[model samples]
Target chain A: MPTIDILLPGFGLDTDQGYPAFCGVFLVRGPDAAGQPRNILVDAAHVGRRPFLWTALADHGLSADDIDTVVLTHAHWDHVQNIDLFPGATLVVHPDERRYAHTPHANDWATPAWTGLLLEQLPVREVGDGEEIIPGVEVLGLPGHSPGSIGLVVHTEAGRATITGDALHFAYVATTGRNPLVFWDADQAARSIGRILDVSDVIYPGHDRPFRLTADGGIDYLAPFALTVTGAGPDTPGLRFADSSARPSWVMPGIQEQRALYEKNADDSARRISRVPRVVRPAAAPRAAGPGSG
Target chain B: MPTIDILLPGFGLDTDQGYPAFCGVFLVRGPDAAGQPRNILVDAAHVGRRPFLWTALADHGLSADDIDTVVLTHAHWDHVQNIDLFPGATLVVHPDERRYAHTPHANDWATPAWTGLLLEQLPVREVGDGEEIIPGVEVLGLPGHSPGSIGLVVHTEAGRATITGDALHFAYVATTGRNPLVFWDADQAARSIGRILDVSDVIYPGHDRPFRLTADGGIDYLAPFALTVTGAGPDTPGLRFADSSARPSWVMPGIQEQRALYEKNADDSARRISRVPRVVRPAAAPRAAGPGSG
Candidate 1:
């Protein structure tokens, strides 16, 4: 049987002030078709996490070339910006995702129109639901957050380990039975979460730590959250980590949320008072993309 | 005389692991043509910063309706995602930016092609470089970061204050004399930075704090950095901030950087080692578009 190692844990933290736009990067290692050991990276994180991703790989005595496959759960800028880092690997994505990137709607602010440019140039293989990337690691259809969002069902030694992208962004979405950041159908998103719950023993979310369903249907985290800051600054003194016990709430507006909010705010609306033109401060707070997050 | 207040500051923090997709949102309050009090928001930050933007405005006892005009520094999704929030405000963008957003290049990943869809629907008044949105608030041409990138030159009571979106993203770009994230022209970017230095007593960047030039040609930050985080979590133990002594470093890969790195890595190189299906670890880190400012 193959095994799974969570290279990093995703934190569930979003704010109204800004969006800490970080997702999970997973690495799955198992035997190839020929029974040879193979390494498959689930997602290549955006540019911000490259240094940390490299370090995470290094800790496991690995490098980008050691892997032979890169599976992208979706094609959001934050989820799949590092494909160039793995030039030798064959890229795996859903065909629907590839098609959607070509004509993404303006409301889909997360998908850059130019993304198709990169996707077109890369050597890619389209994988759909139930397709096996390798033995014991099968692709699962988990759309919602994106049109072609997919998940991975890895037959790990302990049990079934599931990795779902934004379809199951955080633990709350799973427990609440509602995916908050839906870009597609909300009902579809709910069904997708059902798919995740049906197959998952331990679930890894797109922007959160690994967790499992408790005996009484509660949540139990698999690991402690940890992060390291790279560039150091002053205006901020005594930098530390966030509190762990609290619920991880990602304050992002999905398509449905946006539509609802827009409809509400635009109702014969009149907005008020305000600016010295002071932009995002701390040179990073607004662009916080803090240590690591959603 | 009407004055300005920097409700927030932009950060100069970007990492390879993630792209803290954020920019500056400036509120310019002054008298209208009839000498009545008016507020013009320079840039409407993306969805990520809606909470902070709202708080920042409320600090002055203002709301979205108070904004009469919106000056888009450029059309990157990060700079203009929240335009829907200000329905009454007439948007001010360069005609060239408006045109370019119609068909952005694939390399310009920061620009979502659907951007044109949003730009087209807004109540827009195309402003060119050297055009005045209001008294003493002028738009300056500072292309290079994007095809139609522009800057703002505001005549404040203190002196001449300038807001350069990504043309002068950080202090290093100004001092180092080179923009690390150029999508248009390298030489043009250099010239744009020169334009910023020529007519400013103080500078507000897209993703860094406000700073001024000292007598000895050194940079001095005008204020201490402050940030408030919402929806705290655990895995992180200490809740502190960054060091002000260290220089701000945004580790994003520009088109040039990507090409250079791609070339260097893809030259008959075989890279190695790695994985489990573990994606980006944080709910926010992968999507770390953290707190106020860029």
Candidate 2:
């Protein structure tokens, strides 16, 4: 059985004025079938959280090399920018997600052009629905936020903990069928969320803390939200820590455009590979397909 | 002369938790020597700000193609991710910045592994210190946050508006003489900031709004901070907008390690190319050396 730790808790917050720099990072530790120690990192985390990841790992008295496998739920920038840091770890991504990343629309800012190529440079493995990452860890296909979104299910002593990347970004997703951001199919996204709820006893979201479903079907939060704002300037935010006492109504930017593009790309295959060079074909150099191959 | 508009006013705020998702996006609209209207976008905000950029551009009655050139202050992910959207515009960046981006440390999270490769796919024009990007805008070297960090100096009607990328991240750099983050050389970063102050009347920072130097050698902010937090979950921050009120003391992370790596790499040049694939050599496909080469 694997025990999980939230390396950095995700905050369900985004600024409409500019960027929303919040994403969750998890570390799962357990013994492999041979009884050897293993550390599996869930989500590489976007660049902003790099320092926090480092500190968290050090707090565990471990280094990046200590991480045996990195399971990326999705390739959104917020969730997968620090892949390079874990040089010794194998990256486990969905096969379809890898191909999907190679065909992101130019407007899909979340999937930058270099996404596919960067992943190609490193060691990787394709793990999809019903796949076991190690032992007692199962892969769940949670597509909707992006074409190839997936989640991981880890069997723990407490119960079944589902590490959802963006499939269930916030606990609110359980209450409201709508996710804050969606990149692929909303219908599929909804179904994925439902699937997550069906199997998950304690849910680990992409942008929020862990929450368990109550017997009456109510959601109970396991932690409080904390986002410490640094880089203070003269006219920037006056508050160092984002005040959690109050918040605004969420706005879904380009959700319609995102869905329309998904529809458009489904109709036209060529547009799918439009930006593959960065997200396109990647380098001419042959890349090792699986992270374990290295 | 180019008239500058803060298409999206940058908020000087970043959460210590995960990612700092704030970078300024500026639109410079004016006429070329031929007298035709030219729109220049300074700094392509990270994925988080893509919507803000789109909405701002749309508000300006323009689209991505409407801009003729994109002047990147630096190649950090936060400052330059949406370059693909402007398919037709030429990218203006410092030549050394491009090469420097080709070789960044693996731990340098600000400069992701894919920074160089993505820019290689775009139309680029290498501009350097004292070089004119247009008739009035000049490229200035500001290599601190990353080796290739550069700022742009534009001849605005109000006076010279220097677009300082991570060179001078926050306005407080003017008074405190220390940037919150420094990647390449702290000395060079400091010098670059001094140069920005020496040559500019108004300053446009990478993560903050535009400001002017006060008559008594102080900073005069032109705008208030506004970072609207959305996706309000049941347990997330109660505030919709990041409160710009009392802040905590900023802690500097990995400064010593950063400088140590700089010295170590300075001793062993091989370490310079550690993570250049994403920051590495990029693809086997020969990239056009300059954005103008496209």
Candidate 3:
């Protein structure tokens, strides 16, 4: 098997399984007999300490300008945010995506209200169901959570490896085979799962620790971390400094424990801490009696 | 002191602590010397389950159409979501607010994306600073969070009660005069707080419990379960919803506990729950990587 130097940049955890785990982006590089290397960011962490994505690449002597292309699996926020940061790279996306983002009222369960903002900013190219994004990378439309969402199949000697976006988020989903039905179309999500089971020896979910598939039709979604690319080729060696001074992405910390704490303590601190995002507020005004007074 | 009916509709613990809380609307009614009944909805709940500001009145056998006027505290999401729900109800907002919401880049923190959406749906009449919104109600430009955010001053026999909007979110803010400059323009927010303290004897904040200023200069915030609107005229009864369905506000249960649980356990739970609003599946492919990626 050839060596791919995969770099793992920073990511955020939605639900803390235990400690603060991370989502990762991988920079894949391997030397041919001629000693030339290929560079690709397998999956990028869309949220969290995002500047680190650029910094790490610059650290390794790579910058956005050096990248040839980006092969994306799905368009979830955590995986799609930094795409705009790389305005010069050719973006390879499933053809079905452009329509989804532009829908005045997105009907997809997985869509966010702000998703449109990202689409309006970048230059993207759409690929089809079976097209190869590049040599050794085949695009497979894995329509489950989304109609156009796809996964990338990287043909390697070790085995056919898959970047299975949210098609299979965690090992638990694969092991239990229990689909959460949170996808916009459950039938599509299920079909994608089936496609994933048939193609690769490994699965890289959008939000979870990656895992390998077992011979017995089970999945082992428990890998510690994967590597992603951030830097230019071997010519550069130092990382670039991104804007770290920006406001910290408001990560809701200890939401699960906060709920438990509130159950036990029910104090002011407990009340103040929660995992849910804040919505609207109402005035703390008293009720009116009739119209005359004021 | 005259008896006034006060209804404590449900609201947020976090976002409400800021300016949008000032966007509350309400119905102000006491009684004429002749005992004729009057009523109105001060600020309508923007949207969602808790149509409290409107439905609460309905539960009391009065419909929103019967309320005559829907007074807006400010034009923020939380205070403005349900403004359209009252079709025939007159929407009275400050003149500056109408202009601000219409301006391009009204303020640095202004959310212009949704401004056009709101304008298309509301029937609004603008009032100037210090202009009388009604016979007993007055609009005062408290501009701190935004250029046109206002506070509502209601004249009652109990002296003067000011609805500080985001002006003074907590009674403590008015008394100690300290602001928790988390997510807004600190300078403007501070100015709004100062102005609120200078006028009203009692400060009603958007978040914390509301309380009156004592002769000793102390402050008190009320607890949700402890608040009740007491005054009612002979012809007008205090607003009380005997039907729970009338209060369709969305309140996440065990959230404080959820936060505490996440903190205490800091375990696998954090990896499980998604706090961000889900994106619609099939967004446009991310734009090509920029020159920066190279």
Which candidate wins on DockQ?
2
lDDT of 1 by residue, A82-119 (tens): 66556667889997776666545545656643455445
Model 2, docking class: acceptable
DockQ, candidate 1, vs. native dimer: 0.12
User: Which ranges of candidate 1 are over 4 A from the true structure?
Assistant: A1-9, A13-17, A25-158, A164-199, A211-228, A233-235, A238-244, A248-294, B228-294
Q: B138-251, model 2: which lDDT tens digit per residue?
A: 788787666677888899888999988878877877776666676666777778888999999999887777899898887798877655444443244532234444333332
Residue B119 deviation, candidate 1, in Å?
A: 2.5
- Stretches off by above 4 angstroms in model 2 are A230-294, B231-294
How close to the true structure is residue B225 of candidate 1, measured as C-alpha lDDT? Answer: 51
List, residue by residue over A229-286, the lDDT tens digit for candidate 2.
Answer: 4444323444223444333334344555654665455533334333223211223446
Please give, for residues B104-206, the per-residue lDDT of candidate 1 as tens digits.
Answer: 5444556643455455434679888898777888889998777678888889987889988888876766677777776666778789999999999989888
Instruction: Assess each prediction's global lDDT (C-alpha) against the native.
Output: 0.68, 0.73, 0.49
Q: List TM-score (chain A only) for every prediction.
A: 0.78, 0.80, 0.63
lDDT of 1: 0.68
Regarding lDDT, does 2 or 3 come out ahead? 2
| Residue-by-residue lDDT tens digits, candidate 3, B1-294 | 222234333222221001112123345675544556556566554332233444456656776556656666665545554554455556677655554443223122223323323443445577767886555667767765544567777786766777766555444566545454312344666777777777776655654445787777766544332211111111222211122212122222222242243245333222222232222222245689988896
Tell me how many clashing residue pairs each candidate has: 110, 37, 118
